[model samples]
Target: MIDLKTQYAGLQLKSPIIVGSSGLTRNPSKSKELEEAGAGAIVLKSLFEEQIEIQANQISDPNDYNPEAEEYLRLYMKQNHLQDYLDLIKRTKEVCTVPVIASINCYKSDAWTEFAAEMEKAGADALELNLFFLSTDLTHNGPLIRDLYIDVIKRVRQTIKIPFTVKMGRNVGNVTALAYQLQANGADGFVLFNRYFQPDINLKTIELIPGSIFSRPEELYDTLRWIAILSGKIPHVSIAGSTGVHNWEGVAKCLIMGASAVEMCSAIYQKGAGVITESLEGLSKWMEEQNFHNIAQFKGMLDASKLPNPTIYERHQFMKYYSNR
Candidate 1:
């Protein structure tokens, strides 16, 4: 019997197949079923910081809206989300033995950050900060934007006792440096690449529409490369791959590349909970074939940082391929 047990975000997981935060994870009954289906952990659907802010424009005129009423409504929204989220955490913890990781979509380091403490108190094993801004601000330089993420982590790290992770966007530059800085700032783990909603235009109506939310299996290469690069470098920081993982091979490949774990949501949305079982079973069979008994045995076997030819990852000019061709 092979042991798939691995630690992620400072939490011990029975397997690496964590159900990433999405609409599918919001249901309590479904969460229990996912655990039974071999999920190591489940991240609750994210509560957005923007969700609590008052939509002041809803009122046609400034004079028509009562200032006190607007403030009350904003407070109510925040509290409502918190109350329901806390209840979900409590109920999930009761029904499932696996870790229940609470996720929050935060773009700033202010009042919204205070909820981290409450989530910890409410029995959340760990918190996953889905830190990203769908749009960019031209006024801010790269350093300023980067510092925002660090500041958010520092604020929440001071507030919560439970372990926490920062889920980064794909466009983050100099990832090695960012990972090092975030680890120093108090991030227990780093999830590579949070999938964002892709916007598209409808040619006929010229209206905006959403592109595919699901990640393709081929997209795994981007995450695989980073995990291979960062795993050995930041030994203290746990790495979990979020996008492009859709099968048992992807899970095994992630572990082999030095990821502490891999998260799956698109697969669940496409194939339902049985995908978890298929992933776990295939991983165990692969492990047995490779003469390994546990996850750690083969972990980091292909890390670029550990290799003599580490420059292979950085050489993206394709000169060698062209010459060979």
Candidate 2:
């Protein structure tokens, strides 16, 4: 039998197929189904920082707050919601057999550390920090923003003993440097990129429209390129490809390009949890055909370093090819 087991961030997963943070994992029954269908790990739907703050704001009466007291009250509410998230981790761990990774997003370094500790105490197998900051302010330079990430990682690392990974957006100007800093700061692994929900223009209504609920198949290429580029560059850090991985072909490609694992969200949303079984089976069959018995044997085989022309990964070759035709 082909071995589907793979290592991710020092944790041995039953398979390389992880159910990325989504609503599916939030439901105990759906999470159970995903595990039954051969998922290696499950990332619970992320608890948003904004959501917690919103809840806190609603609970606090404006009349009850002097400016100083209001600030204190907000901080208290944020901490309280984080405790609630810890409760989620405990509850999910009690029912799930596979690794339960708690996810958190926050702007403050202190919040990240405190919540990470709470998650560890709640028995989370690992933590995935979806670190996000909109780089819209002119006063903040890349180095400053990068420092925030380092600080966040450093503070959180001190609090939690469990393995932790970071999910980052692609907006950083110096991605390579940031990735290196994050790894140096003690991130066990890094998910290549996180897709942001971009609002669309509804010309007819003259209103901003919500982004697509699902990722398109074409979105996989961006992740593929980065994984291939960063794989050889950051060999020690486990890279997991995410966004638009919808089928076995995409999963196999990610592993070949040096990804330790591939995360699936949109695909699982499009197809049911059973898609995990199909993906694993397809990967196994492909591996057998390729004469490879395990994931590591062929992982990163197609990385840029291994390519005859490394520049192909960096340049837009499609335009050249089509123009020549």
lDDT of 1: 0.87
After superposition, the stretches of candidate 2 with alpha carbons farther than 4 Å from their true spots are 64-80, 316-319, 322-325
Model 1, 5-104: lDDT tens per residue? 9989889999999999998789889999999999999999997777666432344465665988766666676787688989999998989999999999
User: Which regions of candidate 1 fall more than 4 Å away from where they truly are?
Assistant: 54-66, 204-207
Per-residue alpha-carbon lDDT of candidate 2 for residues 1-325, written as tens digits (9 for 90 to 100): 6998889987899899999997888777778889999899999889897888697788557887788888888888887887777777777787789899988876777655766777788899999999888779989998899998999998888778899999978897767688888988889998877888879988999999998978987999989988888886776769889988998999999999889998999888888887899999999999999999989899999997898886777766666677788
Give all TM-scores, in the order shown: 0.94, 0.93
Q: Which run of 10 residues does model 2 get worst, by summed lDDT?
A: 106-115
Question: What overall lDDT goes with each candidate model?
Answer: 0.87, 0.86
Give the per-residue Cα lDDT of candidate 2 at 225: 88
Error of 1 at 214 (Å): 1.0
Superposition TM-score, candidate 2 onto the true structure: 0.93
Listed per candidate, the RMSD to the true structure in angstroms reads 2.1, 2.1
